[model samples]
Target: MIIEELRDLIERHVRPDMSTPVEGVMIARDEVSTLEASMSGTVMALVAQGRKRLALGDRVYEYGPGQYLVSSLDLPVTGQFLDAGPDRPALGFGMLLDPAAIAELLLQGGAAAMPDGRGTPPSGIMVSEAPVQLLDAVLRLLRLFDRPRDLAMLAPLIKREILWWLIVGEQGATVRQLGLAGSNLSRIAQAVRWIREHYAKTFHVEDVADICGMSPSAFYRNFQAATAMSPIQFQKQMRLQEARLLLAASPNDVAGVGYRVGYDSPSQFSREYRRQFGTSPSQDALQLRGGELSLAAGLA
Candidate 1:
């Protein structure tokens, strides 16, 4: 079976850090993991063994063997390994999705066309069953490790093949829009980028809408649909995540970290921090330093 072959290849080639010879590929092997925040970018995560759950805003997604997850935009997400153990660890492969590569394939135009949505909006994240062809392409990509001579020439080609499969799969609409120049997804992505860059500063919706080339109302609707959160909520997530990173490095300067991240009142900052992370900022820092919490908790 393709799943069995993929499991074997991943287990053999995957190092403890999940790095591989392939440039944009990584393998994950975890015996156990807790729900932790991490930044998920444009990538496809295919699980060959065990199960995992991911939370984006209020939405929760769970997948297991023969399944895959696609995050079309960069966002803060909480992930947990649901079923893993020392004897049977959670194993998965992550392949970064390149919009440029997808654009090139779109120009060539030989594969299945994307389904029409008739103005329906698409979300940034999706989960679906991994098709046999996709699994086969992943297997071939991993197999390149066995032939160092063929890797340089073949890796990019296989990577494109894998993306092509995704472009025609159930989540094609989301993947397809990533390459379109003025797509709704692209516009929302622009707004998302602006918010991330200027998260600490307060901005009005009209200004952000102008940046995205949309009216206030339309931008709000589409942005909420794409990201599962309002623009202000998105900014809050970014701010909180950045504060967590700052606290990780300067564990003792809780008030300074909060103020630096735009929190004016120390009490308010502590209150919101506890709400977002389920613990006080000071305590979270201690746990992080003691190695009890995942470093990913600081990522956005």
Candidate 2:
């Protein structure tokens, strides 16, 4: 019954952009779609219907109804709905992970709630089947959409309960890292932020490592472990994704868009963009303009 109601809630709330009246929550219904490239963030996602698959670096993850996925940090990912269209669109829910709320729960829960020593930080993304309690909490949270007055009053409480379920669930170790100050994941998060802000500029790994309070070697290894891509590779992905976003708005200026996103050579930019998206910049732009491709909604 939880799955059925959950699907009904998501279907009723689904929007073209998947935005919901509830902040930090999303409901998506798709009539199938092509593989899409995008960035993921710290968030938890659950499916009530159909199946979805995402690729991050060399790793691939797939989850279907009654399953959930969590990303502990922001990372590059490509994903798609594997089934469902028109007669039975895919249905899903997403909630952005809030470190502050997780930290508060950790404080109340104390050491018993924390995962063991950092060791090698867990991978940035993980998938698990949704337990009943977690699904129930999500269902209750969605019910507030029709109860606007109670929504502002009770939504946060339900959201925290959903997060608590995640913290203590199978991927507890991965979820805990998001709230642990100075954690390896947190440190890598700093490095991720630095690179994202300065993605277009050149910076040595050592300098960025120092910024994250990590040695160059440790930073490189952990960054690779958490993000599944080398620092250089991460920057390149950012450049390509940004170029695509710019292209959506200004499809005519392929060279200018490429250069602005930090490519020095239009030919190289075109080459890499094609390698990444399987289409030339001009063609992808055309597809994007024609509404064949969209970057607006991913697991993040």
Candidate with the greatest lDDT versus the true structure: 2
* Candidate 2 lDDT: 0.88
lDDT of 2 by residue, 1-300 (tens): 999999988888788777888788988888766788888877899999989888888889999999999999888798888886898888889999988888888889884645653767888998999999999999999999989989988998999999899989998888888888878998998888888888888889999999988889999999999889989999999999999999999999999999898889899999999999999999999988998887855554
Best by TM-score: 2
- lDDT, candidates in the order shown: 0.84, 0.88
CA RMSD (A), model 2:
1.5
- lDDT of model 2, residue 75: 85
Q: Cα-based RMSD of the predictions, in order? A: 2.1, 1.5
What are the per-residue Cα lDDT tens digits for candidate 1 across 1-300?
889988998889989777789888888778876778777877899999988888888999898998998888888788888878999988899988887888788768743365433343587888999988999999999988999999999998999999899988898888888777667888888898899899989899999999988889999999889889999988888888899888888899999999888889999989999998899999999987787877562111
What would the TM-scores of all predictions be?
0.95, 0.95
Q: Candidate 1 — worst ten consecutive residues by lDDT sum? A: 111-120
Please report the TM-score between candidate 1 and the true structure: 0.95
Per-candidate clashes come to 0, 0
